[model samples]
Target: MTVLSVDDIRSRVDADFDRILDVLSKKIALASISAHGITGEHMKRSAEFVAAELAKVGIDAQVVQSHNPDGTPGAWEVIGSHIVDPNAPTVLLYAHHDVQPVPDKAAWDTDPFVATTIGDRLYGRGSADDGGGIAIHCGALHALGDALSVNIKVFIEGEEEMGSASFIPFIESHRDDFDSDVIIVADSGNWSAQIPSLTTSLRGNTGVDVTVRSLTHPVHSGQYGGPILDSNTLAAMLISSLYDENGDLAVPGIAADEPVGGLQQDVDEAGVRADAGVVDGYELAGTGSLAARLWTKPSLTVIGFDAHPVDGSFNVISPETRFRLSLRTAPSQRPEEAQAALADFLRARAPFGAEVEVEPTDNGMGWAMDPNAEATRDALEAMREAFGVEPINQGQGGSIPFIPELQRIFPSAQVLVTGPEDPKANAHSPNESISLYGLKHNIITEALLLAKLGK
Candidate 1:
């Protein structure tokens, strides 16, 4: 058995860091951002690029196609596998190639499409969120080269950012192609720099639009002052009822429990607030643990309210108003059930004699990792060897819908979430960046993991 030392992994990671950065920078420049995600052309191109790289590394690669019921190409996947031993446990590495839309260029320090390096940090739209993740995996594989002793597979999806509508079906259709003993999803981040972390849970999400219609047109406020119902007033009342005075969600049938982990540090809190531009006097919910509130408890947010604003104020009662509600449920909760419960709650809580309609827009389940698995143990050991630190187990607040679906399909596989980004990475926000030191260490950790698993 060849045990990889930290120095050995570090040397290999340092040697390939520049090349890995170059690859990621070029890939981000390709503008694979889908349009409402109906087209797969960009996805296909991204997968092809990944496949080409694998070919250069002497690994046989292929594009696996999954089509919709209408026979349209729904997803394009790149599969690169090196089967060193037929009976060895196969590991599947996953990352998404698609990026979110870059809406405001003025808010960004650098062009969102151009991957720029400034003072040891790379800035771009998807750099830390996922581009860096893909690069890490590729770099690790390149470092492993001929020393690999186990079968390895790389699977990249383009629909993850868009709800992964095609992912579950594709996995079911091509079940045999993705057989693996472990799944490494390199899309999440650590608690902070120098602190390696493993994400064990993710919050599920359900969205709904609530519309209130009380009259045909805006009526004069003076005339309607007597008893006429106002949609705006009703909308406000309904929205206000979503939460209790304690800042906890008040929706019926949804569960809220304390998170398993503790709250983030003051530094982490400051970083998150700065990145998000949160206003003063506003604070995150839950008393004891930040991670618990984020990952374990339920949260309801009004994404958008469609009532007329003060700019276009009129002396009349608005006829209709609509608001978008986004509910983040706990990892153990079912999103569909939550959505149904929300709908029922809204129907029952609507103001008397007011017409209320609740409609579900999207729903996705949360993911939980099985800790007692061989692959997880190997990964933890590998991370410890590379970072000289024990990885902290925690949970993420966001939703990665495809993760739960993948777990369902591969029940016996170990799911590991460790990536290069830290708390200050600013993923999905302006001035997004990745720490050079963190990226290098993550690359080393990944290489160590590959070497360990291969052995």
Candidate 2:
């Protein structure tokens, strides 16, 4: 079988870039933010729209409903398969349609739901995170069409932003339906604008909420100022013990190791501090390599705290205080085991005579890919051909929560994590945007990958 000309396919991809972005922008405007991720009606709609578009291009597309054990709305997985020969190896292209909620609309420069283009970037919620990635995949498939010889299977789930609670089960039950020898997860970003990268590992995550209780009610600060067991004080102490002076996690069980992967370009610490609104003298926790601290080691972050403020404070032994802790574990760490270890650490370290309760929430395993696999090599060649640059390998500090499950289901499959977004894309932050230049390159890259793998 002859492969499609790279220049021809790339030209087609470049021509469709604007139209693809328009489709993605319209989808983002529909408010498919999962409502606490309980129901997936909005996600289903987005999946249906993508399926319809693929069908218009003569691709056989369908929505594979993977329900929860209790028959609730689990995850809507969109499958677009085009297989000329059943004996050919299938390639699964993965992305997620669901996005996090835009609760802080006031912080955004433009309407969070509206896709606004400022200069060369498209700004909106989910515009760069996974939406743009999905757009690139669909656009590539549209451009390639019958030129692709290998079976192309596209799977876009609706529950990735969540913990992907139903993903593993669905894959386990219907393994044959989603079986593939190579999988492309277009959900990560490059290390920098010009430096292309493939995510080689993802840190697992576990969340815990701790509550400290002292007295039954608030007492007068003036009367009980001395020897009062303030819940706030206890909570602060507990949270502080989570990290040492050197900024390494003090918790046990979670493993830390020097990064085995290549490091990304160093970010300016001062700039990061300024953007984060940290005090002048404040420094980020930990030492050694910043990328090592983030991608290969465990980190404990106090995400939120609930306590009385000065305005309303009676300053008594404040009845109770609550705080949430997010723990990022190394790729080799088990999330459930790490969660237990963290819970035990908190329980043993709590102050005496204070009622402390620790509750674990949203624990998900991390993922690590075999970087030397044939599929990854092909992907690198494809990226190089499209972008004129060899891709770098890096580990993402964030957790995808489903990649490990996918790995388990397809033990022999090769997983490739590459996408169009850059580090400065502001994903999950205000003014989230995607670069048109990156998008075009990624569309060509995806198309080239299909042709290369088919050959």
Candidate 3:
């Protein structure tokens, strides 16, 4: 089988780019928000759309179902396979189709479901997150056409944004279906728009819900404020205890891993401030370089809290307060151990004899892959050839729970992570967008890597 020249592949992709964006627009319109009980018609439609797209590329695809943790229906997982040759190496392409909810529609410049192009940026929810990933895969396959050389398996996950509630069970029931020689996860981001990057490590994660109870019912603040402790105030203190004056994680068990030596992205202070909407004169928290704080060390986040409405003026001390805590562990740390330590800390720090309970929510272990693996080296070369720049070696601070499972199941398979997310992509945030330049280059790199591995 002869490989298509890079120019030919690029021509194919450029010609079909509009169709690729059309498919992505249709998917974005589905509103497949897994966490918001969107496992019904919308989810089904999204999966079917992907299946049809894969079919266009001569891949046999279907929608596979799994149950949510609460026994409710879960999003449909789209699985597609193309066997070019029995002897050639098989590659599994992984990305999610589900998207995060649009919390505030007013924040978006255009309708969240409508893909709007402003110059080279395409803006919409899921436009950059995984929708871009879905588009890249479809575009690459379409561009390769008859020249694609490897046995291919495309897994467009349905519940990744919901922390993959159905991941383990879905994998358990279809273990044999996912077998492959190489796995390419297109769920991460590039180091910058021009420079491609490969994620070498991912942080582990765990979450806990803590509730503080000070009284059975609310008490009048004017009458009881002097002696009575407010549950909300106590909860604040408990949260504050998790971080010291310097903003480092004060948790006992969570630990950082030794940094991977390579070409790491230097933090752009202005970029960080703008992205975070940080106020003037605010100092960056924690110790060490920004990369170390983000990718190598544990970070704590207060996700949500149960509190009174600020609009409703209440002169009462609250009876109960609840907040969710998420801890991102180092790549080498165990999420369960860190969760246990957090529980212990919360339990011991109950203020003013208030009743405190910490319930663990979820735990996902971290993953690290060999950057020097033969498949990885081939991928790097392909990327360099396609983009005309050396790929950046980076580590992701986010957690992809099922990656470690894939490693364990396919012990010999190489895993390569790549995607089109740049700093300005704003995935999972308002005004999400994808760089057109990055998207094209990523598709080319993936196509080239597939050709390289196929031979």
Candidate 4:
């Protein structure tokens, strides 16, 4: 096959922009949200849609099925492959088809299930997280056409938003099919919409549900609110113990890694305040820049609480209260170790002899890449040429459990994490969207990287 010039690939991607948006629109129209106690039928249909898209670009694709741990139905994983030569290195392209639930319908400017374009951004649920990822893979492959230099395999996951709990088992069962010399995960975000970024590190995570029981039944608060330790008060104390007076993560075993080669994140204080919707007298937590605290440090948040409903709140002291704790662990820390420490700390510090039960829900390890590898260098150059800007190396605070798992499966492979999500993309939140410029540039970037590595 003749080598396509970088400009040629860029032009090809540009020429196919309309078709790309159409593909993205079709994907966004499906409500493929994956969560506990919900059917993944939409995700299965999404897998089929992706497989059909891959087929249009001369790739043979199939939807593979797996089951949840409890024999519940699972999303269908799509696998597509096109080999140029047997001796050439294979590049595995990874993305997910599932997305997070749309929490509030009233918060969106348009229908969350429909792709609506405003200015340069395309708004919709799953538009940026992995749906954009799917478009990138297909667009790059379509542009390459038959002139492709490297063997390519696509693995679009079906349950990423739900922690990818069944992903390892799926990989083990199809280990031979995933053999490759390099893996490119296209589910991460860029540093900014205009600037290209290569994610170099990801924080690990663990979540637990804690329930505090203080009484056999609810009683009138006026009578027992003082002497009896209600579950609400006890749960509040248990939650407060996880933080220090200065508002840092007070867990014993977790600590931040030294900054990545003294590299600081590009975010600023004003941006953080504005993006977080901070109120007038609110001060930031932790020392160092917001980037340091976000990308390299551990943090804790009370994701959800199961106390008395606000509408039906009576003058009663509830007997039991449940809350879910999400703990983001340092990249250098093992999530299981941190989780155990948290459980031990909570159990030992039960306030007023309250019965505390801390049950771990999920644990995923963190990952760091060797930035000096040859493939890494080639990718930086390819992205610079494709995006017309010097690519920044960034770290993500979110955990992708599949990254660490892929590292374990293919220890020698070069792993590149690149995607189209920008700062305002708001992935996993209301009104998630992707910049059209970011999408076009990332597709070109991936195509160029494949061209350079394929030979």
The TM-score leader among the candidates is 1
Model 2 is weakest, by summed lDDT over 10 consecutive residues, at 258-267
For model 1, the local distance difference test gives 0.78
Model 2 spans with C-alpha error above 4 angstroms: 36-43, 104-107, 111-114, 213-228, 267-271, 274-279, 352-355
Query: Candidate 4, residue 277: CA error in Å?
Result: 1.5
Ranking by lDDT: 3, 4, 2, 1
lDDT, candidate 4, 1-455, per-residue tens: 66789889988998999999999999999788877322456777888999999899877899988666666666688887888899999989999888888878999988999999999999999899889999999999988998888898889988888767678777887886688998999988887888898888889999899999999888999987788977988999999988888888887777777445457445678987998899989888877666668887888999999977789678988899999999888777899998998888999999989999989988889888778877788888988998898877788888887898899888988888888799999998888999999999999988888888975
lDDT at residue 344 of model 1 (Cα atoms): 92
- Cα lDDT for residue 388, model 2? 88
Clashing pairs in 3: none
Could you tell which candidate, 3 or 4, scores higher by TM-score?
A: 4
User: What lDDT score goes with residue 186 in model 1?
Assistant: 95
Error of 3 at 259 (Å): 4.4
Alpha-carbon error at 260 in model 2, in Å? 4.3
RMSD for each of the candidates:
2.6, 2.8, 3.0, 2.9
Candidate 1: stretches off by over 4 Å:
1-3, 36-43, 260-268
Clashes (backbone N, CA, C under 3 Å), per candidate, total 2, 0, 0, 0
**Model 3 segments more than 4 A misplaced:** 29-36, 69-72, 211-234, 258-263, 306-321, 349-356
Question: lDDT for each of the candidates?
Answer: 0.78, 0.80, 0.86, 0.86
Q: Worst ten-residue run, lDDT, model 4?
A: 258-267
- Top model number, lDDT: 3
